[model samples]
Target: MDTVEVVCSKLVEDADKWRAAADGMSKAADAAGGLAMGAEQFGKIADERGVVSAYAPLQQTFTTLASGAATEFAKIADTLTLVAETYLREDQAGEHAMRRLEDRL
Candidate 1:
């Protein structure tokens, strides 16, 4: 037979780590948002070769990518937190059941 143990504390710790990463990504998103705003400045009609339209396309792209990544990371962190809490509750219930069984025996 094989045995396995689920450490709820470790899951919570991992969730914290995911949350930190999400925060970092959110900061990056904010910075990218500033860049996105700046990108609008490049859409002038300076030359016929379209040299002035370089960064205008990125007026929404960079911010969207970074923001999406941050959102996904946050979701991962929330899922880990939920899993940890659920496992902890289940473990406690199982332990209580075993104690009752032992007391009756």
Candidate 2:
């Protein structure tokens, strides 16, 4: 059906957008981790209380959290792409079967 085709097209488009967003999220996470480490180094140079040592755990925690978030984002993007492709394939197959039946009639 034309409606099914249209819906599938939209789904594929949305999936592509999601994939792009996931990539952006990963880049952001990487940048954040780099910035946090840089800040830790800077703190060590400027502080007497061994701030870097004290803050190392917090920085590591943030990096880990960001990494986890990026991983989940990638997984979500993959799922969206797979679901869109599957729906489009099924819709095309049904249309093809209908055409064959129509020819027999």
Q: What is the TM-score of each candidate against the true structure?
A: 0.77, 0.71
- CA lDDT of every candidate: 0.75, 0.73
Off by over 4 Å in 1: 1-6, 36-48
Clashes found in each candidate (C-alpha, N, C closer than 3 A)? 0, 0
Instruction: Give the per-residue Cα lDDT of candidate 1 at 12.
Output: 74
For lDDT, the strongest prediction is 1
| Model 1 lDDT on a 0 to 1 scale | 0.75
Root-mean-square deviation (CA) per prediction: 3.6, 3.2
Clashing pairs in 2: none
Per-residue lDDT for 1-105 in model 1, tens only?
A: 322135766777888998898898889889877764332454434434564454556746777888888899889989988987887778789999999999999
